[model samples]
Target: MRSPQLRDATSPTGCALTATTALARLPALAPCLPEFSDIVPWPRRRGCRADAVVGWGQRPTTARARQWALRHQLPFIALEEGFLRSWGPAAEGYASHSLVVDHSGIYYDASAPSDLESLIEHGRISPEDELRASGLIARLRHSRLSKVNHAPDIPLPASPRPRVLVVDQTRNDASIVGGLADRQRFHQMLDHALTRHPDADILVKVHPEVIAGRRQGHLEHAGRHPRCQLLADDINPWALFDAVQAVHVVTSQLGFEALLAGLPVTCHGLPFYAGWGLTTDHLRCPRRHRRASLPRLFAAAYLHYSRYANPYTGAPSTLEDTLDLLEDQQRHIDAGRGHWRCHGLSRWKQRFVGDFLGPKACVSHHSQGRFEPSAVATSTERQLLWGSQIPAATGVSRMEDGFLRSVGLGIDLVRPLSLVIDRCGIHYDPGRPSELERLIAHGRFSPRELARAARLIQQLRQHKLSKYNPHHEPSRLPELPGNRPRLLVVGQVESDASVRLGAGRIRTNAQLLREVRRTRPDAFIVYRPHPDVMAGVRQGAQVSSDDWDRLVADVDITTLIDRVDEVHTMTSLTGFEALIRERRVVTYGMPFYAGWGLTQDHVPAPDRRGRKISLEQLVVAALIRYPRYVDPCSRQLINVETAVQLLASARQNPPELTLFQRLYRLTRRYLHGPY
Candidate 1:
């Protein structure tokens, strides 16, 4: 019994799929359990009741599952891996992304009608589904995703004229058997490719397990034929798709992937996608009577039948979320230049920094005199300094809190899910250009990118998130005279690096408020202290209540910004947030957002930042492109959208502070500096 070691967190449902408990004999059913609710293990679910028997599709357990279902007079469910599986092979113990639960039959079994086949045949493929399918197909092409998404993209092997790809599968694989294929069929697949494309180069692509040496493939020795070259490297399918003109397969998932890639596919056996008129097939499934379009097939197979789950949080997630998770993992794996050495990292930081930097990171708190001879890493190592900026040095990266940072203040020792590591210069110090600035000036904010930025803006405003997503307590103000423009002065940590570098003549909160008063004496001034200052973890300038009409003890940032007409800031990210909310922002100094034709600049614009930019463009650079985000629970780098989703989730269900967390807050004052 191949009960895979896939248990991490048990399903929140606590029972099996359907009202009748499912006797899930395999751990592979875990991803599917969340959607169907209640999941119970084997013997526990065994009873005379109308329970269902379930097993992974067409593996060694299918016969056992069928017998159990037949003897007990209960139904059976066939589960299989979905289209986008994971970052690594299932045999290698990586978690799955999605699963397909078949009540009638499995997808690979073309002899009978499966839910996917039924959906393809009679399912209503709405215009909306087609539209979404078009987008999904585009995403599939862009992501270059396969059933297994482990390999890195490499340059295509240069072969002769027209390239024909022959996909190889492991011996007696369920799909092959269900497709009515055997070792002879794989040989036939290769032979057909070689004969049909006589003048073309036939690239025989081996299975990932074959490349791992875990299983032998039928075409591993295809190189024996001069015209047929064996693809031994664990090459990414997308990369191979770029070079291959057509694909030949015996029910391998790669054939479906090729069809999705817009490649002409010839299936030697009756795969689920074959007889539906999506691909040319040697054998036909008579049950598949309808001619389905590519989008319709994809819609039925991926969107309708498959269930997606977030590998990190064990929460029910969308296909887009899983794709984001895989993309992030792949990017980080590629981002690894060498080993990472974090200098003077604290225990609190040590726990989470590695979640950003991959597992190759080695953290050494300054107290560890072990490797402290200068603390700078050698050429092959990336040096990381926490919280503060390092002197401009090659390979030494500075880490700081991101703009859409957290639900609570970082000074309070709350875990930050996002951080921006800048190699050029920090975003706040406009004295020199940061990587973010470069992205803003040079990045092609395509329609897709702008749309993402636009979504992020809505998430921020809708969820009311900021650098420190402070509580949304509405503050009452003293009644003011009629029609006076409300000017909001945002305070910043005086000793903070942003104030030290970005602030010019009017540096302090008092100075900013006085300037606002001098500029618009008739305006009703509202001053909101920075959360870090309010928490007493950082220093702030002493200002009497007379400087502003309102102290504004407890107010939501977005709500306050919405009520005000204009915001005055000396490099406060509130200025950026206010800008996101479409409020007129007046900056006393040059923030990264200033000088981009977005804000009212009180100081001369930085010479390097003269380009005019839209609000969407600025967001695409700073939030989407610049900062690296990770889910706190999963400790995996996530896309900004996932980050926003996480922040929104955390806001709705705020976790109660453990005793240690409450204690950690007390010592934050000491650690906020120099740690």
Candidate 2:
């Protein structure tokens, strides 16, 4: 008796008790036993109810028994070993079913062996299973069948030239048409075959789902070929088999069907059906060890009787049937309509959601019919608000409605100031009226040299600002009842110094804290590390502390301040938020708002520094100047306002840029004097 393993083997219905012992017991307890050979007769006394009988025997005996069972309408299970032994070692037998058996003596049993064998001989496994298991037969009843159905009835054309059929599914959504590797390869093979055989009619059948309007076809280039005819009309594959002399494929299952038809197949890739002796191989299989004949190969796959349940009905069916039914269900689902939730009301919903409601409205502006405040604003209103002049040679109009519309649509509008600043980090020196005259007198500068003048002015502006704001006033520091004036710096801590070009001496965070403490001994410096910094990519385990004292311990620093009323940052949302609270801001980098003569800028201003602009204008410039806004849902680039709404959710949970802010100040001190 076979001992049952505690783990139940799954069946279509559910788990069933399966064991060698249970099977052995079947012969003894069967109530209606089939006529058995004298060599292995059933025990007559232990009668059990079994609907049918199956057993091992010689080929002649098993065949005779199978005939009798079929006549009596009884199910018969044949032991595979007898067939293999009778066929002899030279005979490969059926390739598909060869590997069905396991070492445990468990073998797959096709419900009707004779029917399954006939289907395999006809090379109709996929379609036959689809008809038997899914409502595909019923669906076909509503549609027209091709004129030809059987292999023999289909007549070959007068020409004996090889015809190649290329099959591929095109509805995969992850890629665009002509983008998938398999699809591209299939087209390449088709082109190669057509170029080789110009007269050959390449019948390209669209996948059934794509034909039925259940999915979109990705093969847009299919129509361009003069020799290729797209089979949009309902035509059976058997009909196609009669027309085509040969087949070429990348990895379609049709290659398998072509083999069963005895037609030569050229595989560009190693599909499951390609390696076995069944098909004429054009491509070598990478997995050389597992190749076998078609029948034995399939027997191992289909005859193995583990039933899969339907997701919708929860009823058991063969694995083949389960897939067919699932595809059918998907087709039906794709044909139906769907509902969508409104996204227009997102801003209203976002406001009441939590503490992360982004930067408060510091200023508001009027547009055509709409009154809204820019969510992200800087204190220097003019630099953020005004539009710059366009040059005549550039053929650009600053006031062109279309140009404004383009800017509003999120197109990068190149401003004279922005171009100069980005290139040389400088702006014009208005205070030195004769500065341009001096350059002209020295023959050192021209109209093109105005850009050089701007850079010098920007450097002077940064120098004067840094000199005056050397240290924060102790009185201006929030009254936290502490002897130390706490300064909080927030932003990206590590620079290219840590990654590409390794500079060993630059300890960015350490240098910044040391400089700030040196400038104001009475102030406590709190270093809040960037969230991205603490993500554990590098900098070792030492960088993981939020505690001020722990963060600034080894650097020349005063006591670390943990919390503060004022926050400083470079391009961090915290900077914008801090400004809404009316806190004095000192910026290290020329993030969009810096150098409008607004917040103290670390970098020199641009050459054509525009008048002080509003926060809205700055937001608009950055949106139009820097990165393009790509819509996630539609995959289209949208305007700045749309980009703003997309990023507005960041306001709800504004992050602190502790590490970056500290590093910027540290770099400044290192470049200026001593850290």
Candidate 3:
């Protein structure tokens, strides 16, 4: 249990080390670490092998390092501000600003060990801790991200009349991305606010994203009413909330923040905070059918759901730490250096990309193969595409792929809330030996991890969630023949990167189905084509007239999976989806999940996957450990749990689209082509 020394530990598994400034903060543990300095330039860190790495959370540098770590069975410990909000040592899957990282485990992963439940169950709130928690709530509200740093000092109205604030979210954001009513809901809320509080002057606070010109908002052409003023001023949200008579929101977290600030909040849309009795909610959620007090809600959301950090010192933090960091950051902002500043080619690209980033966005592309080599890398503005165009750079493909996603033909930004900038690559690529594969094979599986995974698996199964959701209602599954095993042969785009990479010998969906048929002739075959193929955006393996006689393609995969007893794939994620349903999965080629004992493999398993893992362990590695997530609204890093919840909610609610998205969907044929 003693603090580890660099030389004293040669990683038991010999996983490569990917250290960032996080190691510098832990000088006492430095001598025990290996020489990473020898590896000049960040991209080359991919080749270095160490059991574990220490780095700052969530930047291209650390993200790439994490990608490498995950792919090679290397443990990645990300450091950020602790939940208490000062520079205290913290570790989680990635450094999404809102994530609460416990060295023992992450708060989002319910399976990870936590004390929240015990505290709540036992009513063991220490008077000191309770006081601290309450004080922490006030501090967080005063110094929240939407409030602190770079916000202008806008004077409030001196009128005696009460002011009701209606928080307007960005047109396309995480709240919408995660599954809330779309941009139109904000407009409806505006109309409701006008009707509900005619006596009170209404102020609509525009989201920071809209202010920064990344996307549009509902209030753009509302034509200011005498009682309503569209406040596009980049002022502190907390300040606005403090001055407001009451707060109204569709699904913005500001409503939750306002509640923490001890203000009355009315929620028109269902956010995580709605339906908990704290807010006067229009939406009734079955999940949160119970009532809870402000302190309890605060504990669950802030203490349990978020990890904090001290901006000045790189150490584990608390409210005290945040206070100091906030002061320093505010000072920097006042001095005009607090915002993210970028130079170089990355900045150039950012400008060309139509300013999708927020006001604090800063990017730089420095020469010498690294962006800003000497300057300290911050969590503020992320640096990207450094040396990417150069042939010598290791991450050219990743950079190129990312660029394509951002500006590629036919693919609209609305569809993707978070980007997988880590080594796992894109969501669908099973071809590369992603960090997901590494986690499956070598990640330590705790009982808690397994339990969390089990719950997530259950949720996915119960909800029938799939990657790239088919928008239409699932067709009613045909009755299965008595006593015959149903085998679902999922189809994939033959031209897709996943198939090109993972489908070693059997490259086509038709071939995979044929192989499954050849192996299981007695089993009924249900071939569900890829949704992209169904949409005509891409082509799946062409099932010639000869093969069409035996395969069934009309049933929805979501409903179809329920009737199937087995799933067979070369490398489609459908196999993983089936495994979650407790359906037996037979892999024809090596997928990241293939070697892990979960699925039956046709190809020889890699020697690296000798250790048998449970379903939850696989979920933790693939879902939690592997991907990088971001909040679409706040445009900051978020945890996998948040992403999953958002995905599930969005699936159920399915937000209304903006005019552009609707138009894009309608004219998709003209917009789409091979990139």
On TM-score, the candidate that comes out on top is 1
Q: Between prediction 2 and prediction 3, which has the larger lDDT?
A: 3
Q: Which pairs clash inside model 1? A: 15-38, 15-39, 16-38, 16-39
Error of 1 at 554 (Å): 4.1
User: What Cα-based lDDT does every candidate model obtain?
Assistant: 0.75, 0.35, 0.55
For candidate 3, give the lDDT of residue 528.
Answer: 73
Candidate 2 Cα misplacement greater than 4 A, ranges: 1-162, 171-181, 208-218, 280-283, 305-675
- Per-residue lDDT tens digits of candidate 3, residues 1-675? 111221222433343353554444342223222323232223446465454655554445666666766686666655433333311113312222233322332222222233333333343444554565676676666555442234554557677888999887776554453334666777788888889998999888875567678778877554358888778766766678667889998877677778877789988777666666888877665535456667766665455444443121112333343353344334323322223333334333443321233223443434434444334333454334321222222322132222112111223324343333332343334534444556666678756456656766776677666664434555545767658777777777676656665666788877876677677777777677766666555544477543322354555455677787888888877787777778899888776678778888887765656878777887777665444444444343334444555565566666555687656555664655542
Q: In terms of TM-score, which candidate is stronger, 2 or 3?
A: 3
Which residue window of length 10 is worst by lDDT in model 1? Answer: 1-10
How many backbone clashes can be found in candidate 2? 53
Q: Is candidate 1 or candidate 2 better by lDDT?
A: 1
